[model samples]
Target: MNPPVFKPRLSTSYLIVDDHALVREGIVRVVTNTWPHAHLSHAASLHEANKLLAEPGASFDTVVLDLNLGDSDGIQTLKTLRAAAPMARVAVVSANNDLDLALACLHEGACAFIPKMGSIDHFVRGLQTLASGGTYFPRDLLAQAQQREGAPTGVQPVAAISLTPRQHEVLHLLLQGLTNTLIAQELGISAETVKLHVSAILRSYGVANRVQLLLVCAGQDDSTAPQTH
Candidate 1:
């Protein structure tokens, strides 16, 4: 006989705030996967979100709010929800990878920054973290900040001339333009994981792909400005 299969966990209702329909669907898929009994609603703008809250409705167990709402800006959007539902746990979902912005959001009491392309597991974990009374920053932002504090001279070069330790490694291998397999071998991780990191790096920097990522990574001097976030 086979062992019993596990069932999806259930939770209270959740709200999704995003201008994009597909993003809302993805959030629903991830949230419901973790909380099968969860009742969810979506809003395309801050106005709609407020209307939903004001209507005769049950309180949300948690709210996943987009910082860049169609009618609202980043941290300001978060501030509105804080006033709208003072008791609800709110998470900031955004694509902004700026360190200053991430810190500002956290300072303003956003429960987390849920990246659009971040894995579902990370997203769920962020929600859980908020549920547990902690805030969240994207892993990259947190890592970069920590490195700056613990290391010297903001990790040097201050521009494309310099690289974060990770970027340095990626740049070196990128110069070779080797197959994904070669880079994976040098890094000692699976090729697939490398691909994901590369994709994230490119997206964060708004580059076309690996070649551009490398080109941008190179051709910088010590005084050159580092890319945003």
Candidate 2:
């Protein structure tokens, strides 16, 4: 039998926040192809993006944002946007593919980090993952992150850390980069319950947040980590 097709929960609405018109145009083409009926809004600066995000009843399934906006630069742009649209998945597309910056973006709740240097297909696959409530992070970058942190490359066994069975399930999804909301939907649990399990998992690993937990569980299978395509 064929595998079941994944369906997105939200209607396809996107906010593309980038300072470059050319980049925005390219992304628009990719998104249009992915979701033919997708509603797209463009912002050339952080200020313009915030205005659109703050509009009453504004809801976007995803925000494809550039870290180096004209009004804001670096991770602060992500922080500000996260506050403005807490419900939207924010994907960072940047010229810099630095592993540390990518991890920082994840720590700040970005659903994906796509380096501008990557191919169009990579970006398209990322959009598809986000649409299905999954996150996309480049695998090579993640390996580099583990290397820099003095951890072995690829997923390591977590048998050393004792956790409840449910916490183990939560940890698996967490390593996959699923947000609490998505994890709740996958596990058929409340978001609050997912949050509690995540907190407990953090304590069990003696880590503070999702990013740290990921580092602690660096032995996890790479397939379980965020996808690149």
How do all models score by TM-score?
Answer: 0.54, 0.69
Candidate 2 local lDDT, residue 65:
95
Predicted candidate 1 versus true structure: per-residue lDDT over 1-229, tens digit per residue: 4333222122367788999998889778777766677789899999999998888855875678888877998788988886776545567777776767765655454546667656767776666544433345556555564443332213233243323445444443443333466668877878897777666555555555543343233322312444322
For model 2, the stretches where C-alpha displacement exceeds 4 angstroms are 1-11, 148-192, 199-209, 212-229
Clash counts for the predictions, in order: 2, 4
Worst 10 residues of 2 by lDDT: 220-229
- lDDT for each residue of candidate 2 in 10-97, tens digit (9 for 90 to 100): 4389999999999999888888876789899999999999999889988887899999987899999999988887767788899998
**Candidate achieving the largest lDDT:** 2
Cα lDDT for residue 169, model 1? 49
Top candidate by TM-score: 2
Note the residue pairs that clash in candidate 1: 159-224, 161-220
